[model samples]
Target: MHELSIATSIVDIAWEQARQQGGGRVTGVTLRIGRLSCVHEDALRSSFDLVTEGTPLAGASLAVIEVPVRIWCGPCNAEFELPGIQRFACPACGHLSGDIRAGRELDLESIQIAPDQIAADTPEAKQPEPS
Candidate 1:
């Protein structure tokens, strides 16, 4: 399934970010998935678990934030969220809108890592010497 590939990509990103921040094991990952993104949350979670095995994100929790589909109605000159995916009509003017403003996002928002895994010599952990 494509979800497997998506999960693999997420794991890769999280691992890279964690390492770049100083070689830490990810504890959690937050993703913003839009309704129009067509990504099933359950399937993605399952795939994440499978893909992260033996990796830095092995026991990391995956958190998904659902984003509603928003569209811009040319006739109404207004932006509103779609009540359902099937209906692309403007709620205020009842006119069909093809101008999608949002709801197609599949972004990795943030990642949490274990504190102990971070390098102590990093700039954030460094102490100033006496002048």
Candidate 2:
């Protein structure tokens, strides 16, 4: 599925961000997906889980925010959300707006990361036994 590819890309982005920030574990990722973006949220989540396996984001979760379709009417000089996906006409003036202001967004909003923790096997993590 294409979601797998999208998931992989998301992991790549998160990994790059984490690396740039000096190496940390990703906790969550927030995405803004428009209704017209044609992405299946459930499938994307499942794909993300599958693609993150054995990666730094293995335990990371995805939060998807659905964005509604918004349009700008030229005749009425007004901006509003479409009543339905198929209806591109403005609700206020009933004018067909060819100017799409929003929606069709597939963007990564934010990424949540936890500070890197020292591994138990690391020398810095070893503790001396009490005398």
Candidate 3:
């Protein structure tokens, strides 16, 4: 349900980029999703498919780059990626760290456009602006 809104927002951004690029056909979208971001990949993919229906982004493939949670170890003085989201302790020194280095991202990384293809999907489909 929340993924649906996120998908809608992604499409909106893609549309704006497409329009800026002279309305090229969007073929694919890449998203960087973190483990701690609380976004289900399967649900997001399904929502993307639904939101893209009959729009300029219809048939666009969605690719997700899964990022693992990483934290900075102060005692060890290094950053390590956790094997899972179970604990936030340092692997080497066993020190607990509240300094998070990464793994809280939900960003639309890139968009692929096909210039050879004409923009023709649904007749009345206009790219909606992001609210």
Position 38, candidate 1: lDDT = 91
Tens digits of lDDT, candidate 1, 1-131: 89999999999898899879877668789999999999999999999999998876776778888999999988778899998999999999899888999999999999988765353344333223224
State the lDDT of candidate 2 residue by residue for 9-109, as single tens digits. 99999999989999887878889999888899999999999999888787677888889999998888878998578988999988887788888998999
Give the per-residue lDDT digits (tens) of candidate 3, residues 1-131.
89999999999999999899987879889999999999999999999999999987888888889898999998788999988888889988889887888899999899988773554543434434334
Predicted structure 1: lDDT = 0.85
Candidate 2 ranges with C-alpha deviation above 4 Å: 118-131
Worst 10-residue lDDT window, candidate 2: 120-129
lDDT score of residue 111 within candidate 1 = 93
In model 3, what is the error at residue 5, expressed in angstroms?
0.9
Report lDDT (Cα) of residue 18, candidate 2. 89
Q: In what order do the candidates fall by TM-score, top score first? A: 3, 1, 2
The candidate maximizing lDDT is 3
Task: Supply candidate 1's per-residue lDDT for 73.
Answer: 89
Model 3, position 90: C-alpha lDDT score: 90
